[model samples]
Target: MSALELVLLLVLVTDPFGNLPLVLAALGRLDAAAYRRAVVRESLFAFGVLLVLGWGGAGLLQAFGITQPALYIGGGVILFLLSLRMIYGNAQGAFDDGYAADPLLVPIAVPAIAGPAAIATVILLRTQQAVPLSQLVLGLLCALLITLATFLPGRRIAAWLGPRGVNAMEKLTGLLLNLIAVNMMLEGVRRFLG
Candidate 1:
């Protein structure tokens, strides 16, 4: 993939829209102000997690004797499962109900934003690429900004999208994720057989 393609794929994999449910779920209980805060926090935290992965994850994996094929196999599985959740799981609105009484750090910041799929992607991608610390920081920030922009205004965004738009977006994202999953799985299989 070209550099731009890689970046776009990264964005697709990161999937700010896909993250909406988890974000809303985690902050759904809070008032608007608190909800906004939680959104910002989750996005920033996600950025931090990605930045660390981009900068140091590959080296750490290598130190532990991890191989590219292994990463492809493992990471692909994680990504597949995560993307399946995005595709076949609950209605998008379901996530907004649980956050009022719970902590935003758990359901929101974790698997929602910085989940295993993300960590594995970072680790796997970091193998073929080594982002400069500064570039990694910038990339993470850009993703966070996107997440923040989408999430903080979810109600309005949801309204703007209406049912039609949301459904279309979800389907498109799912399609893209399926393609990504297939590619990852193929990469793994190829390396395993090579």
Candidate 2:
């Protein structure tokens, strides 16, 4: 794929919309001011993580003797399980408690936004081709910016969507995630066999 297409796919895999339920659920207990601060902080945190991984992830994996297929399969399994939780309406246990002073870097930023799929995508993109490091970073930045945009107006969105609407959206997102997860797994298997 072209660089722009890769960036777009990364944004989709980042799955900010899919993660809205989790982000909104975590933010539900916060006041408006706190919510806005948390969103910005978490977005930056996720971006930093992605940037680091984009630059150093291949080296780190090599140091640990991990293969690309392993990364793909492992990430796919984690995403599949998370998506299942969303589909079954049992996602609460998967999230941090609402009482967290700030769930900035944990559920919201880590696995929710800069998730396994996203991390693996960055690493794969960086290592699999002659693509410039700058371009990979650019893609990561674009994806994170889109995530920030989605999250900044979250309160208004939650209010407009209400509980049921959020749930429906979450289910749809979960379904999409499942498809991505399966594709990842299949690709991993193909690479491993080849």
Candidate 3:
């Protein structure tokens, strides 16, 4: 796929809107400066992780003989579940004690931001082959940057949306994720059949 496609796909799978609630909860206790710092740190850290994975991911997966469809389905399932669980309150244990107090880096950093889905998408981007490595890096970085910018202002955005608006957007994004899950399953079936 093209660099633009890769970036957009990453953005969709990452789903900053899904993160708004998390941001609001985590930052509820922090002061303004700390909130901003945490936002920048978590997003940048997540970006760095994805950048490394995007650069070397294809070779690692190829070495393991993992097929593209396998990655897609597996990653999508994990992501879909993550979204589903969060939406349905089935993912309450994503953090341990003290997490609620300082979750800016732990749960938010590792999974909420970088996330399994984004990591898998980076690997899939590697298999595209037509795209140059530099372009791939650029795409991933661009998407991550977008995530950083988007997520930083999430609290404000959430406020503007109000509870009703936020819930509406959350459900809409959830529906989108459900579609992504079905697409991933279909891709896996197609590849297996082929």
Predictions in order: lDDT: 0.69, 0.77, 0.72
The candidate with the higher lDDT, 2 or 3, is 2
Candidate 1, lDDT over the whole model: 0.69
Q: What is the C-alpha lDDT profile of model 3 across 78-194, one tens digit per residue?
A: 767766755664222454345665564567767876788778767766664446668877876787678777667777887888877866666676677667767776787788788
Could you tell me which residue pairs clash in candidate 1? 25-95
Q: CA shift at 148, candidate 3, in angstroms? A: 2.8
**TM-scores, each model vs. reference:** 0.84, 0.84, 0.83
Q: Model 2: clashing residue pairs?
A: none
Candidate 1 lDDT trough over 10 residues, lowest sum:
90-99
Q: What TM-score number comes out for model 1? A: 0.84
Give lDDT: candidate 1, residue 131.
49
CA lDDT, candidate 1, residue 60: 90
Query: Which has the higher TM-score value, candidate number 1 or candidate number 3?
Result: 1
Which candidate wins on lDDT?
2
Assess the local accuracy of residue 63 in candidate 3 as a C-alpha lDDT between 0 and 100.
92
